[model samples]
Target: MFDGVARWWDGFELWLAQQWFPVQFVLVAAVLLPLCVGMAWVIHRGVEAVADRLGRLCRADAAGNGHGVVDEGHGGRPDAVS
Candidate 1:
């Protein structure tokens, strides 16, 4: 099975190499570029969401509020004693 897959891949690569350079470049730019960018965007958004949730959790813990309600000017830190 692995050998067959490798052989198929090799054939596909050879066929790709035989294509005109411009065609290959256009295919990559038109198809692969957008695909990579979209995937990156999705990953970045997912990471940002996780970070936001973690930040809220930390803030909630620090404030002892349990609700993650970040107050103004303190930046999620608990109020200081006068």
Candidate 2:
């Protein structure tokens, strides 16, 4: 069965190699376009999910840290009260 599949693949490769340049480009694009789009969509979704988790973590940290937030001009450190 493996031999058969390999032979068929070799034959197909030869046939594709003999095809015209435009035909080969079209055939490859037909397969690659959707594949690349799907991979990009998956990556985009993963990035969005990570961004959401990071945002949640940042909000939680801010809430847990209580007062003094960070950008209040104190430079994020405790004020000097000699």
Candidate 3:
């Protein structure tokens, strides 16, 4: 059973790697380019999420009236002595 599964996977890999030139660019565009874009989009979203979370953490330590810090200056820092 394991050998059969291995054989099947090997055949699938060969099929996927086969270079049929007639529609090579189409296949690359359809399969590879979107894959890269999707991966990049996922990475961008993850970084944005991390940045938002870090911003929240930094804001949590700001000095204010406990309702969270309000941006009042060029650097978006909390108001002085608030």
Candidate 4:
């Protein structure tokens, strides 16, 4: 009863495994790994820029709406948006 189905699966499983061999290799070693590294670099740069801007704000002595006032001490850093 189950003999025909079992035989078919035995042949098909080998072919399916061979086809998926390269797909699994490329997904981990070529695609996902590099994308993870690139995304991390982008995030690091973005966070650094925000931190630098915040540091400038903390060190300055701005009056009014934190705009127009020139920060001569810090080489005129631009005001952060509200």
Candidate 5:
């Protein structure tokens, strides 16, 4: 199976190498540009998801009393407002 796949790939590579310059450029760009954009979008979304999760964790840790206020004193406890 692997040998068959390799042989097909070699033939494809040779065919690409024999194409005219403009045709080759268009073919490479048509195959690669969308792939690059898709990968970048996926990476961006993954980073955004991780950032959102970390933000939520930090907010939860800061808001110890569930009121969303971080205490600047009293050893990191929730602040009490009168």
Candidate 6:
């Protein structure tokens, strides 16, 4: 199966190499445009999910006491978030 596909890909590559520049350009654009768009969409969704998680954590921290606020600890120094 792998060898079959590899041979087919080699034949296709040879055919594409012999094609006109416009045809090559069109094929590249046709393949790359959707691939780039899909990658961008996935990245955007991932970033959105991360932002949502961070927002929830921030809200939770804000709702709790002594979070993001400097309170005196055992040595009268500002305490870290707990």
Best by TM-score: 6
Candidate 3 regions exceeding 4 Å error are 1-22, 64-69, 72-82
Candidate 4 lDDT by residue in tens digits, 1-82: 6999999988876665676777757655786788999999999999989987885676564554575555556444554443
lDDT of 2 by residue, 1-82 (tens): 9999999999999999999999999999999999999999999999978876776577568867895254434433333243
User: Rank order by TM-score, top first?
Assistant: 6, 5, 2, 1, 3, 4
Candidate 5's residue-wise lDDT over 1-82, tens digit each? Answer: 9999999999999999999999999999999999999999999999978876776677677676676675456543233353
Minimum summed lDDT over a 10-residue window in model 2 is located at 73-82
Error of 5 at 38 (Å): 0.9
Tens-digit lDDT track for model 6 on 1-82?
Answer: 9999999999999999999999999999999999999999999999978876776566567658655643345332222354
Off by over 4 Å in 1: 65-69, 72-82
Taking every candidate in turn, the Cα RMSD to the unseen true structure, in Å, is 6.6, 9.0, 6.5, 10.3, 8.3, 9.7
What candidate 5 gets wrong by more than 4 Å, as runs, is: 65-82
- Provide the global lDDT of candidate 4 against the true structure: 0.71
**C-alpha TM-score for every candidate:** 0.63, 0.76, 0.54, 0.46, 0.77, 0.77
For model 1, how does the per-residue alpha-carbon lDDT over 1-82 read when each residue is reduced to its tens digit?
9999999999988987899999888866898889999999999999978887887778767669556555656554344343
| lDDT of the candidates, in the order given | 0.78, 0.79, 0.73, 0.71, 0.81, 0.78
Number of the top lDDT candidate = 5
Model 2 segments more than 4 A misplaced: 67-82
Ranking of candidates on lDDT, top first: 5, 2, 1, 6, 3, 4
**Where does candidate 6 stray beyond 4 Å?**
66-82
lDDT of 3 at 8: 100
lDDT of 3 by residue, 3-35 (tens): 999999899778767867666667668988889
- Comparison by lDDT, 4 against 6, better one: 6
Q: Supply every candidate's count of residue pairs whose N, Cα or C atoms clash at under 3 angstroms.
A: 0, 0, 0, 0, 0, 0
Q: Candidate 1 has which clashing residue pairs, if any?
A: none
lDDT, candidate 5, equals 0.81
